[model samples]
Target: MRWSKALIPTHKEDPSDAETTSHKLMLRSGYIRKLTSGVYNYLPLGRRALLKVEAIVREEMDAVGCQEILMPVLSPSELWKETGRWDVYGKELWRVRDRNSREFALGPTHEEVVTDIVRNEVRSYRELPFTLYQIQTKFRDELRPRFGIVRSREFLMKDAYSFHRDEESLDETYKSICDAYTRIFERCSLTFRPVEAATGAIGGSHSHEFMVLSDTGESEIIVCECGYAATDERAEGAVDPHPCDEAPGEMERVDTPGMKTIEQVSEFLGIEPHKLVKTIIYEADGRTVAALVRGDREINEAKLSMALKADLVVPAPPDVIEKLTGAPVGFAGPVGLDGIDVIADHTVEPLVNVVVGGNAQDVHLKNVKPGRDFKVTAFHDIVLVRKGDRCARCGAELNSFRGIEVSQAFKLGTKYSSGMNATFLDEDGVAKPFIMGCYGLGVSRTVAAIIEQHNDKDGIVWPLSVAPFAVEILVVSMKSEECTTLADTLYTDLKTAGVEVLYDDRDDSAGVKFKDADLVGMPLRVTIGARGLKSGVVEARVRKTGEVSEIPVDDAVQGILHILETLR
Candidate 1:
């Protein structure tokens, strides 16, 4: 590709709405341009990089014995409705309708469509235990998409689904896919961790997310030195129960004014936040339930939903809370709460005296004791794990990191098969639901994450394996016929040698060419200038290391290829 003809529109200023490093760099580098909120148009350079990523993903998936297939981005509503996800997937499902008033959805994922294919085609266990993968576009109605393509509404994804006859087969394939994922990210030069994750909306028995470590990431992960890692929503750590050696104190209602938050109430009562119990009312599967936790902690809604065995769990609306507790939003309490289930965090079990809501305006209860003042229907670990918390596996203090989730693997078991009746006949002639697994790699997001981790102030430092071009031949002085001729000769030689090379043949100044080269960040750069030509050599620089070497004019192609090999 020639820079004079290519649409590499490098910019000097950042986009006004760009917040993260990746977003700002991508715009300035001319990789993508915003078409609308949460949507972008990939330019030539961006498309080339994306294709390389897709090629890597395809190779990895193929090496794992997975067959490639394509599915429609517009999926029928019947398939999602069959799995009960049409309503359960929430507003992000991108629901639509055809002219005939038939419903459809732009698929955020392909689990339902894949399951439909398997159920219709395969009927025997002999054809089971195979994986099908597709690299395609996916859509989601993101309420607030930010960070450029990292959280875009429309993006490229490589999603794979596997079907199995039994749990053992599913487990075997799951491990293989996870291993492939590790290799995929490593090949892209990403520093990441695979952490246990909650299977949100994508119903599954177990899942792990490949999180690229970055301070600008949107997801929070809890990590331990003992190899225990999980997304904060799925992390489990030891919590010490409140120590109470003294007898239970009598609960008393006290009045202040307008103390709604835990901080406000604790400040008004002159007590630490840990000394108070937070009563959080939620609508778990349409049943009103109150969850109790230490005021200093936060409720993990994923854990709460799992504990209640509910399909959905959301905080009750203000109106519902006011009607249930006879008070405003933050004043609900479990004391004397009637006609509802109450679940308490394990950290609150041993408390003898604590503060709680008074269930009335401008009121709070002090010295309230659990088991004496309110009844807890059950106790579970429902608090979000934090730094300094004890690890459940090794008893070490936990560490936390913000990360970008680039890929995720799920052991779906029979979540979709059971729901949609995707079954195969076994040797015993009994129909059994197919055990399934899902693996997804965010192709577009990985590109953004790579920039988030691999970039400096100059621009994106692309890994050679996924770089848009392996070598860039810059004619530093196009005005000099000698420099332009030498650059063209080297470009031809490299192209003939099967190198992915880009030629900056435009009549641009040395400074502009150098700046654009750094912004695009090719792996290797060969500078052919009049001064260098006079010296019988060309300047070669490695983008990542900034290592410069003088390559003899006669050996420019060979030297550039050698440097690219080392980059790989």
Candidate 2:
């Protein structure tokens, strides 16, 4: 592509509203333009890059057993209603009415629609283990869309769904998809990690998210030094149980004037925080519930909510606590009560002698045994494992890092199939719900995340696998016959050798052309300058390493081809 014909609207100054590195560089380099808060318009350069990404996706998907198909961006509300997502999807699902008053929606996802399509055709389990995929635009009404395409309301995505006959079959397909996703990201030349993920709104049994580690990532990863890594939501760790390992002393009563916080009470009585059990009131499922955990650990809300399977769970308000427990917030505990439903963290359940609230102001009861002193309906992990905890997989130290989810694969296990009656017949001719596994990659978000991971202080350093152009040939002095003629010859040769070359044949200074070439970040750069031309040579620069060398004009294409091959 020649600069004279190509739409290379390079900018020297950054846009005011571009907050992310990808958003800023993409606009400044003439890749994308923002139309609104969550909407964007892809210019010629941007469209080319997106097309390259799509091609990569298509190739990788086809390499696996996936057959590509195009799905509708607009879908009927009746499809969503069949799966009961019409009410559960909340505001993110864009709902509309047609001219005839028929309801429709711009699909945030296609699980409902895809399953609905297969339900009519899939009758036997012999048709199981089939995968279908698509690269299409998805819409979601993000209430606070920011960080450019990373959290946009409308974006491109690659979604694949698989049908299975049983749990083992689903497991096999899930592993295959995970492997395929790894290859896809690898082909895109992204530095990413596949971490365990929580299937929150999607409702799945097991899922893994491919996260490109970046500082600006939204998801936090709890890491361990000894190869132990997991997301905060799925983190299972080992923590000291309030340091009460030493034989706890006998139970006792303490009276104070006005100590509310655990620190205050521990300091006033000269006791360690590990010896006291903290009591909290949570209002869940329309009931005022009391939960007791150790004073040292904070509660994991995701863990607590999953244990109860409640629709809503939150800390009980101040006035509601006083009316239900006959005490203020901090001073409520289970001492003389054995009729209330209570749950404790696994580490907290083994405490034979621990201090707890005495249901009054500035009072505490020590030597509290969990099962002996207080009755409980369940004993499970109610608190989160903090930093300095054992790993769930290999028992290593747990560390933490925040990430943005680029893709996820889940084992749906008939969650939607049963709900929508999408079943298949077995060999015995009995109808049974089809098991499912779903996978998705956010194409636009991946673009933003690649920039987040691979950019430097100057600008984005696009990888060869996804870069629209493999080499940028800049005529340093376009008006000079030697430079322009040599640049034109090199561009044609590189293109003939199957290299995607961008030729800057405009009348520009060496500095301006070099700066624009660097901003565009093709893997290889060829500079035809007067000094190099006189020496029968040209300057070749590596965009990623900023390494430049003088090479003979005849060897320019070969040298660049070698670099591009290595980078890809």
Candidate 3:
């Protein structure tokens, strides 16, 4: 490839709207251009990078005995409706209408479509225990897309779904795909951790997220020294009870005036933040439930939803809270509540006397006991785990860090197979739903994550395996026949030697070519110049390590190949 014929529009300055490091670097390097909010156009260089990542994913998925197939991006609404996800998917699903007003969806995932395919084709146990995969584009209507391609609306993904006749087969294939995913990310040269994660909208019993540690990541992860790591929504912590030793006093109503929040009440009563009880009102499956926890603890909604076995749980509106508790938003309490269930955090089990809402405007109750003054229907661990919290595994303190989710593997069990009626006949002549598993790798997001972990001040330092070009030959003066002739010879020889090389024969200045070369960040940079040619040598620079060396002009092709072998 020659630079003069390539569309490498390297920019001198970062775009004004770019926020994350990957976003800015990609723009400056001319890899991608923004088409709209949460949408982008991958230029030639970006497309090459994406293809490289796709190749790695394909190789791994193929090595694991998975067959590749392409599914339609536009799926009929009937398929989603059959599984009851048509309404459950909500706004993230891009729903549209055809000429006759029939509904269709730009698929954010292929579970429904893939299951539909299997149900129609495979009707017996003889066709069981195989994985089907595709590397394709996906769409999700993100509410607030940011961080470049990290949360984009449309992006490339590699998704694989496996069907099995028995639990044993499912387990074996799950482990195999998990191992393959590890190898895939490792070959991409990423430092990542696979943590236990909640299934979220994916509707699975078990899942693990492959996360790349980054400060700019959207997800917060809790990691413990005992090797227990999980996303904050799913991470568990010890519930150390704080017993009340002081004698209980009679409950009394105190005039809080305009004070409503925990901070205001704590300051007015001269008590620590943890001494007060926090009351949260939520609508779980259309039933108003009051959740009580320590003043300093925040509710983990995911855990709360699972505890109640509800399809959806959201914070009650101000009107709903006032109507149910007879108090304003922040003044709701659990004492003497009517027509609603009350749930308390496990941390409240040991408390003897605590402060709660008075259930009146601008009033609060003091010296209130849990069992005596108020009772909870259930106690569960719905507390959000934070930094320094005791780990549920080994009692060590947890550490919090941000990470980008690059991929996920799920033990889907029979969630989809049962819902979609994807069943097969057993050898004993009994029909059963297929045991299933799902694995996904975000191809475009992986590229952004690679830049997030591998770039510096200049630009992206692409690892050799995924670099658009392994070697880029930059001629100091294209006008000089000597420099151009030597650069042409080296480029031809490198290509003939089975190396991915880019020749910069454009009529551009040395500084311009050098800046673009570093910005694009090929693995090895071979500089051909009049001065170096006179010395019977050329310069080679490693993009990742910034190590420069002089190579004999006659052996330039071999020298570059040797360097490429050492990287990635």
Error of model 3, residue 16, in angstroms = 1.5
Residue 502's lDDT in candidate 2: 89
Alpha carbon deviation, residue 45, candidate 1 (Å):
0.7
Per-candidate Cα lDDT values, in order, are 0.91, 0.82, 0.90
Model 3: per-residue lDDT, tens digit, 18-114? 9999999999998999999999999988999999999999999999999999998999999999887898888999999999999999999999999
The C-alpha TM-scores of every prediction are 0.98, 0.86, 0.96
Question: What residue runs in model 1 are displaced by over 4 Å at the alpha carbon?
Answer: none
Q: What stretches of model 3 exceed 4 Å from their correct place?
A: 257-260
Summarize candidate 1's per-residue lDDT along 1-568 as a digit string, tens digits.
9999999999978778899998998899999999999999999999998998889889999999999999999998999889888988889999889999899999899999999999999999999789999999999999989999999999999999999999999999999999999888999999999999998878789999999999999999999999999999999998765576877778888885899999999899898898899999999889999999999999999999999999899999889999998999878888989889899999998877788998998888988988888899999999989888999999999999999999999999999999999999998999999999999999999999988888878888889999999989998778888888788888888999999899999887889889989988888888888878788999999998999999999988888888877888
Candidate 2 C-alpha lDDT tens digits along 54-88: 88778877887888888899899988888778877
State the weakest 10-residue window (summed lDDT) of model 3.
237-246
Q: List candidate 2 segments past 4 Å from native.
A: 13-20, 224-228, 245-292, 310-340, 350-375
Candidate 2 local Cα displacement, residue 346, angstroms: 2.6
State the TM-score for model 3: 0.96
Judged by whole-model lDDT over C-alpha atoms, candidate 3 comes out at: 0.90
Error of 1 at 430 (Å): 1.0
Task: Judging by lDDT, tell me the better candidate of 1 and 2.
Answer: 1
Q: What is the lDDT of residue 11 in candidate 1?
A: 90
